[model samples]
Target: MVSFKFIHTADLHLDSQFKGISGLSDGIRSFLRESTFTSLDRLVELAVSEQVDFMVISGDVYDAQDSSLQAQLRFYEALDRLGKHGIGVYVIHGNHDPLDSPRMKTGKREHVHVFGPEFEQVTAYRRQDQRAAAVIGGISYPTAKVIENTSLRFQRDKDNSLFHIALLHANIDGDPAHETYSPCTQQDLIASGYDYWALGHIHKRQILHELPHIVYPGNIQGRSIRETGVKGCYVVQVAEDGGVNMRFHDLDTVRWFHETIPIDSIAGEEAFQTQVEERMQEISRECPGKMSIVRFVLTGRGSLHEKLEEGRIAVELLHELHRRAIRSASEPSGLAGLVWVESFDVRSGPWIDREALLKEDSFLGELLRYGQQAREDMTTRAEVLRSALNPLMANRELRMLLNETDDEECAGWLRRAEEMAVLLLAGEGGGESTDED
Candidate 1:
């Protein structure tokens, strides 16, 4: 066995086109579109700085079924840069970039080795000593949908003297968050007896086991709000005794954040605006040199809730924040240091005494009681609530973007609806009775 160091990254998703994000200026949109490439550049820079022996990309180097010539060339060029540094690159294709997809031709370089549809074995050699470092086993998806378990077919190269690594892109144990392509279990992987498993296809970074080091480095860049937070890869070093050490390096050029501001105690509008400004300033310091896409969720009951929807206060505040962000990004401080306010969601409700409302004998009180009952019995109410909102759920556009509502999600929506109805529909005369009786 020999000492070695390498970077393990997956789901580069180069040239990613974002979805469900809109209302951006042309300049901002261009910046958003170029973020994936920026992150890739950063990843390459990290690899060179760390002086890794090699780099392993588990899957999904491209974002589309058919990779454009420009993307292919750019990817090849990145590998050429690695070649200059005496770093070898091994790549596998996932469901997103299956080997069967038609791709534009790019000049092949000697440093980059892309796995084919079947299982293959490759080896990484240390540049300084010309000693064998590790033997890597990998396979690629023949097509977008691989029903069979690809992990089962991987046959280790029978060279146990060196560190053995398995590279795969799979939905481990059929994770519901992603499509169940090339599904396999942890037991199956441990049985393979590989020293390290570099996995892809799940954007959330997780370490399933440490004895043999089964890990998911996660996507280098998050493409949507659903994939929020800092995204990056791992740098792993193996010692002569075969002790594996892995550390995460943040390479996401643009970050995604969902922040909730509770305004239950705040009464004045000036105070509310002050709170928002302070939070924004604090968030700017988090990832100092990267653009942050933020979605502000205003939660908790307050006087501000009355103005949020009725007088278009929420929308107005969102626009004012957007202007501030634009001004900051355009300054000499740099656009990368600014926070982009992606959206503002008003989930707060008007200040009201729930105990008093429950005690009243009015129709509104009766409705409130039933709503609570239905919410409590979510196991049975989920179906009924979904059926009642069938028209909205059936909207073709909604179906394309969202998944079927689960019980917890359905219950939360029901709760929000109840709160909103109590505040908005209760007339001005009704308000004299109690915060809208």
Candidate 2:
């Protein structure tokens, strides 16, 4: 039995521009640009420390097809360091970095093996004896759009006694969140007769299967709020009996987080503000040494819900939080910015006693009753409204002027309209009948 150890990582996306998120300070913008390279440096450091046999980068080594010279140089520098340790590298270009993409002229890179445009097999050699340790089969995207199932082309020799691994930058089972590049299914992989499948392309990490271990190590860094949480890679050890043991390692220099705060427990505006600040502190503590880019979502009913309904209130709160974050960064610890608010959303319902309002015989009671009916028939009303508006949207000019409206947006509009009507009809107190009032 031949035992081998290796690191499986992908989606380096070196030098990602991060166009998805905006309205950031210059400091944060600069940090984001250098983050991928920083992650690469950490990856190299981890590989050397772990003393693995080889590192297989599944794909997307660069963020774009025409990668910048700085990104290429940084990548080569990391590879060269791995080479110095006699650790090998197996790489395949993903849709983002295809065969036709412009690659830097780094001369001959030692101990680096990259698969070509077609499915083929290669070997990671044992350093001391130069013996074949693992048979790796993989393919690169020819020009970015890989319409076919590239995994079907992967073949392994059943007669061989060596450990087999398949590396691919494919979207298994057509993940709706990602493009269907090099698309394949779990059955396709299982039929290929490989001991392990190292995958890439998707930015979220998960294990798809086991026995013949199937894994996705995700991307090295979080580029946007959409790609939040811990981003990293995996180290796998194949035992003498063909059993596999894999462990994950963190590689992100800065992380992204989305936090939702329920406002139901808060009694007033002051308490609500305190809760927001407290949550920010907690999230910042969760990521002590690294910068945390966070998106906040406020939901559930409370006394402050009515206050948040004013268009400028949420905006004011967001700006206040931003100022607090800036202060935290400039404080005596002298660390760079630690927390940033990506976006703040207030989606809580109004804090009104509907039963009491409905008991009243005035117009406000009728209005509340009508609003209740609309809420109950929200789906039917949304469909009716969309049906009426679809014909108008069919016109090219109107389509250009107006955005498409989904059910959620329609419901929100109806809710806000009712809330506004209540505020106007019920006056300053908003016809309060709460226990405290």
Model 1 root-mean-square deviation: 3.7
Candidate 2 lDDT over 1-437, as tens digits, reads 56778999999999877744665666667777888998999999998988888999999999674499989889998999999999999999999988888886667776998899878888777765677888999888889888888888977788887899999999999886788888899999999899899999999999999977889999999887778889999999888898999999999978888789888898876787787778878877887878888777777767677778775666777788777666666567633437777776666666666688898766778777876777789665666556756888879988765564445556666676777777676766546545652
TM-score of 2: 0.83
* Model 1 TM-score relative to the real fold: 0.88
- Candidate 2 Cα errors over 4 Å, as ranges: 330-337, 352-437
Candidate 1: tens digits of C-alpha lDDT, residues 314-342: 67777887777777666777676677777
> Per-model C-alpha lDDT, please?
0.82, 0.82
Query: RMSD for each model, in Å, please?
Result: 3.7, 5.6
Model 2 lDDT at residue 89: 96
